[model samples]
Target: MSATRTGGRNGERPVDPEPLPHPVVDNHCHLDIAPYAAPDEPVPVAQALARSAAVGVPRIVQIGCDLPGARWARETANEFDAIVAGVALHPNEAPRLDAAGRLDEALAEIADLATDPRVRAVGETGLDTFRTGPEGREAQERSFRRHIELAQDLDKTLVIHDRDAHADVLRLIDETGAPNRWVMHCFSGDAEFAAACLERGAYLSFAGTVTFKNAQPLRDALLAAPADRILVETDAPYLTPEPHRGRPNASYLVPLTVRAMAAVRGADLAELCRAIDANTETAFGGTWGA
Candidate 1:
């Protein structure tokens, strides 16, 4: 539905995981890219939501990191009661648009879209040093600062996408002052970085990546994070969890991540699910209808 040849486009669709004991929201997902990654046919937003609902994932934050995706996110949120929107240009995209001298124009449009009721956050933003090199860092930082300011200006939650740039992300947040509400989407840092983010009142949203055998550090971060400040997401159709690694991810697979989080935190499964539901609402402002 958005973005061409996304990271998700390579895997086969996986079977659904067991249903969660309590309702939870996939704090981040890319409904627009689900079909491109796994199956031949695109799963309509309605079908995707229904599939998730049948399990206990009742809501989702549809993140749009480009202009067209932003439009899709807002429109989809408006059409579906279970969805909300977050808009921004991804860090890697910032330099491309900047080189074309259209960065400001794009940011301006994002600013305009940020005012929509269904648009609950101003992100999928922040530094992504992994994909964006040195020459692109300036534009990424510039775009990040702009998004932080936009979130503050609009009193909306900020969703950050920190990839191999944890220090810079913390620096930028400190320099600009984080919004009242913000989340480290698909948090990939260790306990130290997790502590840093927690110190700044950032919610740590764990994705399926946490279930990887090599993700002990991330699990440690989860263990260290305060219960109220934790969230769960699929980041679909990527980072498919254990038992389904290399397969297409979706909201329905959230239960796998939630279960892993529960085990890591040594908390009750249903309790963790309930906390994730509440944490997601608090992180994104509130439930879509409320």
Candidate 2:
């Protein structure tokens, strides 16, 4: 994701929120993208992990949306006990690669990287109408279909990134068949849409966007979701939670979103945390970083 995509304050990182009552996994995060810092500043992967763990986010699933990112995520997961990797070519990227005649080559590399033990999921791959225009839709759908098939064949969790393309996402899933384990990452749909995903056996992951004042429909979806199938994420460097909504985000800020979710769902904080943790493991195909 681009650092400027979410329109965050960028000057100051948000203060850490109170720790969660129990630990929960950040089911999706882009540790490689540090929008808060400058180009010369190294990505503080270790520091990010420590801060998040201090606030009860002990594990994270680092997602790689392109070639270099896929490699970085794999390498980072191998180095950090608290992280696992998810690899794919983002929907927007697919068109560019296709235009350059590199889409096939890129997907081939993603396939290779995804087989690693440290890589638990194959995605962040799905339709994204908000960014890519009509000209790119075909390439996006083609990529999404390939990633879906790849996930099933490899027995890895399929993590989808649906943005303003919910109907097409569900249609593609129905056409290709959902995998044994899949997630609607950073779920941006309403109660009815949530029901559609849940019916298709998806783990709906709420991100910091859930805390936005304008996100009543998202909150309703949270309330409508069953606890067992719910998950949480930061999608950091983007979608920073409210109160800190226009600021650079990191996993340490996850508690803010989780707390908001509990409030919306009228669920106990600790119980919600526990369910999210377990749901993440299930969504990602078991535990790591023990």
Candidate 3:
């Protein structure tokens, strides 16, 4: 069974201004930024969604990191038929969740999220040595483990968030024995690191960083990524791709990064669209082949 409203090659309907290059899947985005953001926000959710729709961002995983944020993610995604939810404790925010020590509480929160059919993946979780200190490392590790367990228990795909802790993240994934079809969200490591993760059955997702001229290494690594294993993300309102780089990011901008990914993979726009769209659908437990 497939979602008739938003799936496959015919997932999109025509919008304004420009023709959509192709339908895209925004692998990750934090919609929970509303609390910290201004109430009279310039970029309203509808506006952001319209922009995304305009550019053929047919599906997006609105990730929720904190307790309130996760709840908001659900509400926000519910507002749009095409958007889905990916609920998890971001590494930096993992300390706020007591999943490792008070697992029942954490499980309850997860169950609350999972009860909603649209919450597709279980993360934005994993190690982040670049930001986490020694005191926070233990909690981060515990949170990562709990997220893995949560994915296993819920039978949802895991969206890993690894940053400057590639080795540690790989160790944890190996030690825990991850379920099939996990995506390394916003993968930041080099080609070798990507290869290592690929060997472990984890898909490497590239973000707008690959579009940076200085990101030649990311460019090279992307070439090594097999078509079946490559995915694209915005990590928005951050990592906006070129021309729009450094500006507020959104799912609508996914096509820019998708174009860059296609160039790296030596695939044309159509081929890249089909491949990435299929991989994203598979990652989120949706049927891709029509």
lDDT of each: 0.90, 0.89, 0.75
lDDT value, residue 116 of candidate 1 = 97
Ranking of predictions according to TM-score? 1, 2, 3
What is candidate 3's lDDT per residue for 1-290, written digit by digit as tens? 11111111211212233334668788898644521223224246667777787778867788876666677777877777778888877788765454346534764686668667777888778888778777788888887887888788778889998888988998999888887679998888788988998998888889999999999888888999898888888886577788765455667778778878878878888778878888888888885221
Pairs clashing within candidate 2: 8-246, 9-246
Give per-residue CA lDDT, model 2, range 218-285, as digits (tens): 99999999989999999987888999877788899999999999999888999999998888877888
- Give the poorly placed runs of model 2, Cα more than 4 Å off: 1-9, 37-39
At residue 148, candidate 3 shows an lDDT of 88
Better of 1 and 2 by lDDT: 1
TM-score of 2: 0.96
